[model samples]
Target: MRPSIKILEEDMKEKVVLEAMEILEEIGFFVENTEAVEILRNAGINVDSETQRALIPADLVKKSLKTAPQSISLYNRDGDFVTVLGGDNICFDPGSAALNVLDQETNEIRTAVTKDFVDFTKVVDQLEHIQAQSTAITCSDVPEKISDRYRLLIALIFSKKPIVTGTFVKESFEVMKDMLVAVRGSEEELRRKPLAIFDACPSPPLKWSDLTCQSIIDCAKYGIPSEFVSMPMTGATAPVTILGSIVQHAAETLAGLVITQIVSPGAPVIWGGSPAAFDMRKGTMYLASVDTILMDLGYVEIGKYLNLPTHAYLGMSDAKILDTQAGFETGMGSLLAGIKGVNMISGAGMMNFESTQSIQKVVIDNEIAGMTYKFVKGITQRDEPIAKNLLKEFDKKTHLLSHDHTMKWFREELYLPSTVVDRSTNEEWITKGRKSIGERANETVTKLLSKYPGVSLDNDIIEDLTRIMKYENVDFKTKLDL
Candidate 1:
């Protein structure tokens, strides 16, 4: 049996869902998009145009819960399976919209730029453990209005992996859709093989921003998958109790589901979030805190109860760098989320409270992801009663290396990590340079980049994407010419 972890019992999960439904009916939520409010009004929902308060009824929530697809498929640009999101399917990707990167050359945090996004995508493409890629960092070099779209463009041009991206600016939404079409050939084909999933977040305290609301409706209309990111800060924007936080998360995501399904029935969406507890002592939100992991697992359990695909922010560090603190936090968060079977666990390369990205840290986390996945896979009984025969034939002079059984099962039974992790004796360490994990990871990154061709697109698609970038007045060639 595969190793797994869960905290909420079935009856407890039902209670959480009931509480969420009650919150949606009694308290309601704010809908900032005027069109969204009108859609709800047309659906017989009680709406106050002045306050934007949409009191979604229990029937509407239940209908949405029924209509939303239970599973979502994300394909790479080449139209291949990156992951099927639902049930026990688990996948990992780096986080999005980080502003800084830990510069390997200088060993200092620097503002991330377009090149940083490109290089990050290259690393993600090479990591077998990372199933999908996100617009890992926003390039400060690009125009603020087009940064989100620019990241998507870079992802398409550099990596063939499925992408997790979003648009913060409303006007750029159509442009982003057009950019996707440029890579995907046409609108219908793009929808049929959606190479990316957009993340639409709802504001805390029961509010959905106009952009995010429109994103939900647009993604539904376009037939692209969307993830509802309901970020609730406990003891600040939400209730302090963990159960209360999950209830709030459920309510918020349910509101999104209602909006999305209302726009287009049976639209695909994932139950996703990046919530955390507010630490009064530090005067900050502990997104990578251990408590946050519990909260994420609880929300995922609720999603599974509804038979929906789930996602969460895990495998990140609240620590400033790739030190001991980063190691333990990332290891624990990744292992727990993987074993819990979160469909799409984000925040792999994240550091310093998820504000920065690092190539070295990503390399390290890639190894962590491999080990966690191995642990989740558990041990399989490849053969029965074979150990008795092997033991009977074994002697003090015999070696397992000489046996055929050892060679056949060793590769499958063990997780042989790459050079990113060190497993050497003191003498072996001295023979080498006694390099740190960071140093070894840096060397690996260098080797990977050296082998990467830097660009992976047909001439026609490249020209079209560049034309779109130029239309936005973005200097795409300047950064990608390498």
Candidate 2:
């Protein structure tokens, strides 16, 4: 049997969902977008024109849930099927929208530039365990107006994996969609095989900004998957209790779902969030806190209970550096998320409360992801008689090292991590210069970049991408030659 975890009981999940529907019916959500207001007004829901408060009835929410797809299929840039974001199938990608990167040479956090993002994309492309790439960081070198689509452009040029990306402004979505269409050759094909999932976050305490609401609607109209990232900080923007925060998250996510399904009856959406456990002493929000991880797992359970694809900001650290705290927190969160089988597990290279990205931490997290994948496979009975036949063959004089059984199962049973992980003896370590994990990861990063067979897109496609970006912002200067 596959290993799994569920924090919310069956009855509790029902209760949580019911409370969320009731909250939407009674308290309502503040919908800032005029188009979204009209959509709700046409859907026969009560909308206050002055306040822009959309009172979505429970029946509408239930109907929206019925229309929203349970699974979303994501494809690589080359139009090949990659993975599905539903059920117990889990996929990992680096977190999105980090402002800073841990500089390997200086070992200090600094603003990320185009080069930093390119190197990050290269590393993510080679990681065996990470299934997708993200617009992981914003480029300081580029103009902020085009930053959202600019990141997507770079990912399209360098990596072949499907991206987990989003927009900062309402107008950016059309340009971003045009870029994806350029890669896929047409709008219909791009919609048929979605190349990316856009993240649309709802403001806390039942609020959807005009930009995010527009993003949700645009994604729905184009048949692109929209991931609802509901961030509710405990004891701060949301209620102090974990269950209370989850109720708020459910309400906010349901509101987005209603808007998406209303726009396009069969549009895809994932039930995802990045909720935080507030530390009152320092007034800091901890992404890696046990409380926060529990909240993520709880909401994922609720999503599963609702039979929807789920996502969470787990497998990341809040620590300032890649120290013991980083390892402990990243390992715990990743293993738990893997065990729970969250569909799209984000936050592989993220740190410092998800404000920073570390390529080295990403290299190490690849191994963690590998191990977690193995752990969730559980113990398999490889032989017919279980261990009896193998045990019968064991003798004092003859060990299993030279046996055929060992040769057959060792490779599959054991998860041999990359050289980034140190398993050498003390004497071997001394001979090999005793490099730290960060140092080892840095070396791996160098090796991967050196051997990276650069993606070769047709000249016409390259010109099209560049033309799209240049059209958006005439002054946009890129580190890429194109």
Candidate 3:
């Protein structure tokens, strides 16, 4: 069932736009890189060479933003299962795993390998609620070409919905192209139906690092939707003020959008960002709060103002590891923001500033996503209509609990908890061995990873993928222990 979206009002959006412009022009942005300073200055912004800042007037910023294509279309192999870039699909992705979270069964934290990644993908395939599978885990098996090789392995394993991925190297971009050609069967087919990759940009102003920017442009040329993530860290990376952060994030996103549009006119793209403030108390960013959640949502508003499909970080927490703090923060933030109709809310089951990943937390987050979906559904009105004719419909003193209608809709109305939770009294709880929620979640993840079977591409397709890997100059899969 699709959730009804509540779009921001036109006037309200315009107000945000006007305010963003004012902030960009008046407040400007603090930039340190002289090369980046030159880029903005050459673009005609008023650059303070001594301060190394770019004070873009509202008109220029608005004009720069106008360079973006309003909407994007993401397609898969066979050009099948294409979803429009915008609207209320509300996609969820796994947490970024440049680092690892606690592994309960292992009794200690460990770096992720290719086996770990394949296991994660297998579990994600079974989740009816998780619409898109992100290229989340880092592959230690093929160290040299991880960016290229893992994407191939995942594509080989799962043939589900569209994938949200990004490439860190030049060959990885070509490796992506090879996988697209293999899955899509032809360059024409792949071109017709492309994937969406998250092109990340360092924030506080619009500046692209060497390899990442080039890779994103390559994807754009091939018609892949590039979801630009402008990660603006408050205090350290960006200004401390939330409003100032918004302007800087906007500028960064708009700049990337322009470059993508230039690479491929009207190519599919997203104005996505997840900029959060630094918690002085904890000294960590991505803190969950009304401010944190709303700030991200508010940026989505600014993005959608351009009539573009938007993405924002949600379902993530500042919790150090998997525990109560993680669960509640995940539940509250994802629950509320999903209710607000955030499209492509990622950071689900992620912790420790998205560097750390947890499978247990992902399961818990799945529960939270399910609950949020239910909350936003509001309530059905079957009883309201039937109540008007209650006397005529039922005999006096009859128990409506046993009515035939009760059996039909009861299941639909209730959100039964998954294995991660318990719905019982003290007596029932004692009888069940009283395992901890985290422990139970660990068992569930192990079970899913063990029992679940994922899609397998043809042998010829696998060979082609391997050949592409050789071209990628990465370690051979046969030699790797993974």
**Model 2 clashing-pair count:** 0
Q: Which ten residues in a row have the lowest lDDT in candidate 3?
A: 473-482
Better of 1 and 2 by lDDT: 2
How well is each residue in 240-272 modelled by candidate 3, as lDDT tens digits?
776666656776676555445545566667878
Candidate 2, residue 245: Cα displacement in angstroms equals 0.3
For TM-score, candidate 2 versus 3, the one ahead is 2
Query: Local error of candidate 1 at 100, Å?
Result: 0.8
If the candidates were sorted by their TM-score against the true structure, best first, what order would they fall in? 2, 1, 3
Q: What is the TM-score of each candidate against the true structure?
A: 0.98, 0.98, 0.84
Residue pairs of candidate 2 with colliding backbone atoms: none
lDDT of 2 by residue, 1-482 (tens): 89977798899999999999999999999999999999999999999988889898899999999998999999998899999989999999998999999997888999999899988998899999999999999999888988999899889998999999999988899899999999998989988999999999999989999999999999999999999999999999999999999999999999999999999999999999999999999989999999999999999998988889999999899998889999999999999999999999999999999999999999999999999899999988888888887787666536789888889999999999999999999999999998999999999999999988886777789888888877544543345754
Model 2 lDDT at residue 155:
93
Highest-lDDT candidate: 2
**What residue pairs are clashing in model 3?**
none
Worst 10 residues of 1 by lDDT: 470-479
Kindly give the stretch of ten consecutive residues in candidate 2 with the minimal lDDT sum: 472-481
lDDT scores for all predictions? 0.88, 0.92, 0.66
